[model samples]
Target: MPGFTLHPFTLLTASTVFMILPVTVQPAITTPINAALHAVAGPSDATDRYRALVRRLADNDPRWEVQTAAWSALISDVPTAVTDFLSPGGGYEKARARASQNASRNALVISRTISTTTATTSPIVHLTAIRASYGTLAEKDRYVRTGLKEAQDLDAKHSPVEQARQQAQQDRDYVADIALHGSGAWVRAAAQRAIQKSTDNDIQEFFKYSWASAAGCDLQAFRMNLVEQDLAYRHRLAQLIVLAQQAQHAYEQASEAAKAKAAAEARLAWSTAADTAAATQASWLANQQLAAAQAQSWQQVHDFAVTASTQQDWPTIADNAAGTSGSWSDEVAWAQSQAAEWTAVYESAKASADALPGANPTVSPSPTA
Candidate 1:
């Protein structure tokens, strides 16, 4: 645990899981959808095809409310029900839509169930819940019917203590990644200490409470780095101003033959600096606007999550909302800092260019992003 290091992208995977959940496509009972679609092609063949479709619908293993409706059609007058089931906007399509609605509601319940402390503590259930939360409606339907039992069976293979031991190894891999790539020295140290403790309780502590402390430490480090960068930018500008003054003086004192060339070179140097600085300034301004928009987008997500908690009672939305808020908030801070820094650089460069000899100070770089 002392020197554990993982690839940097390992943390990217660790942090963003819902974006990349594994999809296991289970084989369905054959001909279900095809049987429905082709059931009423013509009156001659409709009888056989309708029976085939009914059998297929009946055979859905983890079928939702749709199967019950299919049974209703099966028990009624066969010829009339068959046509009704097969025609456009008919019994089969309505059943499926109802099933989809049921699946959606089940997905919400499953999300809240797995986010419960008892369930979240189990790694297998946690994994299953993530798949259900981000998965499609069909996937959620299958998960609601079968995935919970599968997760429970997997969890039963080991004692709770053993499961926790296995989970600690996974957490160690994540903490090791943080130790290497986390923003501040303090955060890295905090990650390292969690890895060294090598206990399930300690790792849980790190995830639950210590992560906020580490983030606070990184905030201080970020501010310090911003100051360092701003000071370096100003010092570079000071150097450029001094060079421009020295070149102007040199051009004035140059002999007749060299004065023209000297003046030309000084003007070119200051003009190029102004051009480069202005380009950087515009780039940062655009980046600032983009960052602000991203922050606003995350705020919308947070608002939706709040609404979901009340309307749908989905508590799990809060975790994703909080993570996106923190990440986008960083973007907002960086954009603001860089935009201000580059504006200063551009102003200094422009002033130096204007004071240089033999340059048309009125000529400015185009202000375009």
Candidate 2:
């Protein structure tokens, strides 16, 4: 009774009531099984059964950390351990419990991340995390591992941090260009002072964030001085027109680049969602099957106990069988919940993929004189 579960039936006073059903003699039991049915099996053909279990576990849910751990433990070290592991109250149940814990933690992590991240400007990370959160345990863990870093990289393309850096660099170029070619004396002085600063932050700050406004000051002075229309004014005005046109060209280029990046990001997100959904779906199916097998196995044990078929083996397994049925039922519900999560992710990703626009043809460059 040390390791056995304490179900009501397990506490039955009469020896006749404690009898285990020996229904495992049927070899391939069809009567709903209770894993207490493990009393029927022996090692005569365990080699074939072991290999079969390996294939079943591998093909069904190879990405499962539990499966991976089992592989590592049994693959090279002790092939013979498979029989005991698959038996009632064996490694299989323990692994299932661990997987359940992992699934619970995954739900918590994904929920927190989903709440923190929104589908605003840069949605790749948000949606990607959303889908992976609902994916298989392996996929969910992957988000916590490398997927988060990858999302950050993708988000950084247009993220505030990266955008700020880009703007600072753009402003530096703008100031240098204005100082050399277009600005009047006052604006040129301002631009030069910014460029000459010891820290790059000064230039970035002067151009954008802090005290001196890049456009309000320099462009105003250039426009004001150009209106005089003297020989110097005319030359500077022509330069300013050229700079304006250049700015327009740069705007169009940035627009096209942004479009392309969005399309590519959307495509990748859809693909990830699709793939994760498929894998999670497969995991759901595998879990379903395992739960069904447990259910049937429990049924067999319950029936065997009622009829008092094999009183000799009853004491050996009575305690373990007490709660196996409940655990099997719980596994079925867990699998269904995971399946629903996968479905939600797949549908959301599919809709987003359909809604996103594709890349457009490149625009022709401006004609030269």
Candidate 3:
């Protein structure tokens, strides 16, 4: 009674109610009930039925609600039946019988739950679908692995090769940039050809040949330019040396002319001084002789005056003394004037001869050729 109270109808109650009902009506009621139960329960194949039930449970499917309600009602009877069979008042033999019955009933309830929740599917169809899906995934994985390996191999092979190609392209661009703007027609044409070459290899070869040719031309041009510069420099140096030697020779000739002119001027100055000195000396000697004659005339006049004064002849003494005194005074004045004039000339001539170059009388004068 205690366990049965939880359910709306017990198994005993249902049996009793059926027994009370007439046999003719029993089939009608039982038939519809069995049909309803079958509708709620699913197909017989366990795996496909389970997959269907899980699909119904997902996505808020309405089938899951009906199946859940039915499962609840079915399992509600199990706990009550088990509780009543295992109650404490039973003896050992009865307990053993009840336990076995309870176990059987529990197993039946579980079996009914599984059967009602599942739908039927053929084993062959289920296996085929599974194999197709799995095969697709496996094949895709195999393809992905193979593609990744090939990609890795290609990258490893071409990395350095691509880098070298890029470097070569850069070098070609540098050369082309210069040559395209260069002065020479051939170099520029070569640069254009290098640019138009189809492959990196061809382009590199073109650049190589062009550079070699340009270098040779540049070397020849440089040599010609250097030679021209060197020759011009040498010619200029020789001309400067000739001009310097001519200038030096002219300077030496001019210096000798200046020395000869200076020596001639000195000789002329000495000769002029020597002639003046000789004239001054001759004039001084003549003046000295005239002074001696004047002095003798004065002495003769003084003796005549003394002889006349002793004879007492006043007139003759006055006349002779006055005439002689006048004559002597005039002569003395003339001698003094000539002596001063000659002395000045002699002193000036001696000074001029002393100041001239090489005018020392002890050093004989050099003959001027």
Candidate 4:
């Protein structure tokens, strides 16, 4: 009697009476959902007929509150079942999924930030490059014009060719100096563009670290523009230098022409003066010779007159000299006449000597006259 077991129906009724409605409802699972649900529902609700019975109870049971409560508890157990289901895939897969989601979100945030930063800063970078290029070009152009003006002024002032040449050389050197800067800018631009375009390790690393910084891509356009400006400036400078050189060359040639003209004029003047001097000397010499000949002819005439008068054979001399006259009186008269004519000729010679440009005439007749 002490070890006797109760009848099955009595045991069932007693179990039902003692059974408190569980707070949690068992999940009406068609099959084993997972371990958590399995503990609550047992294997009974896993079959289709049991799930139908539970549903029928939910719809028609007199104690709806208790039945709903039971079902609710069963439904609440599904979260644990889901947790159990995830177990087969391993914790690593879940961890990997979580990591992937986090990484994607972070990457999206970074991409948006970078894109926004790029959008905001790109215009500024472009503007800065443009301004730099424009400024450089302007400065270079100004210098070129200034140099050209200076060359023009110097030439206008009749500066010496050597001085002008020096100025031109200085201009050329200045252009050369600027050319280096321009060329350097161009070279740097190319280098920057290359960096931007490269797929090298260094560039990738740079991009990785430069998330909040300027990209090589942004700098390339600026560099290229600057270099273009520099080259233009250099070209302008070269043109200026050429102009200055040309001006200097023209000045030198003009100077040479002026000097040649002056020299030629001087030679012409010297030749004219020499010819005048030669003519004057020759005229003076010719005058002197003519005066000497006139004096000699007068002396010969006077000597002949004196000899005839002294001979007193003047009648015979006269007869011979006259060739058709006859008397001693006539002869005396003719001799006196001849003497007077000789004296007259001598007086005329004396007057001519006095008329000479620098003459000092001292006239005395020969004793025969």
> Judged by TM-score, which candidate is best?
1
Better lDDT candidate (2, 4):
2
My TM-score estimates for the predictions, one after another, are 0.36, 0.31, 0.24, 0.16
Whole-model alpha-carbon lDDT for candidate 1: 0.51
- Tens-place lDDT per residue, model 3, 1-369, is 001111111111111110111111112121222122122123332223223222222322112232343344334454332222212221212433443454344444334433443223322222222222222222223323353344335444543222114324445554455344432233344556657764664355443334334322322232222222222322232233333233334444556547545544544443453344345345434534433443343344345435432212335534543553454344345434434433443344344335544546544332211
Position 306, candidate 4: lDDT = 38
Deviation (Å) of 288 in candidate 2: 14
Would you give me the overall lDDT of model 2?
Answer: 0.44
Deviation (Å) of 102 in candidate 2: 2.3
Ranked candidates (TM-score, high to low): 1, 2, 3, 4
Q: Please list the C-alpha lDDT of all candidates, in the order they appear.
A: 0.51, 0.44, 0.34, 0.30
In Å, residue 169's CA in model 1 sits off its true spot by 12
Candidate 2: give its CA RMSD in angstroms: 37.3
For 1-369, candidate 4 gives per-residue lDDT tens digits of: 012111211111111111112112222232222222222222332233224333433443223232453355335545432223223232212333453454344444334433543313443322222222222222223323353345445545655432111122222222233223211233223334324544342232221222111212122223222222222322232233333233334434556547545433433332232233233333323323322332332232233323543212334323332321122122234234323332332343234324433333433322233
Best by lDDT: 1
> Cα deviation in Å at residue 346, candidate 1?
2.8
Worst 10 residues of 2 by lDDT: 15-24
Q: What's the lDDT for residue 305 in model 1?
A: 46
Model 2, runs deviating above 4 Å: 1-47, 76-79, 159-369
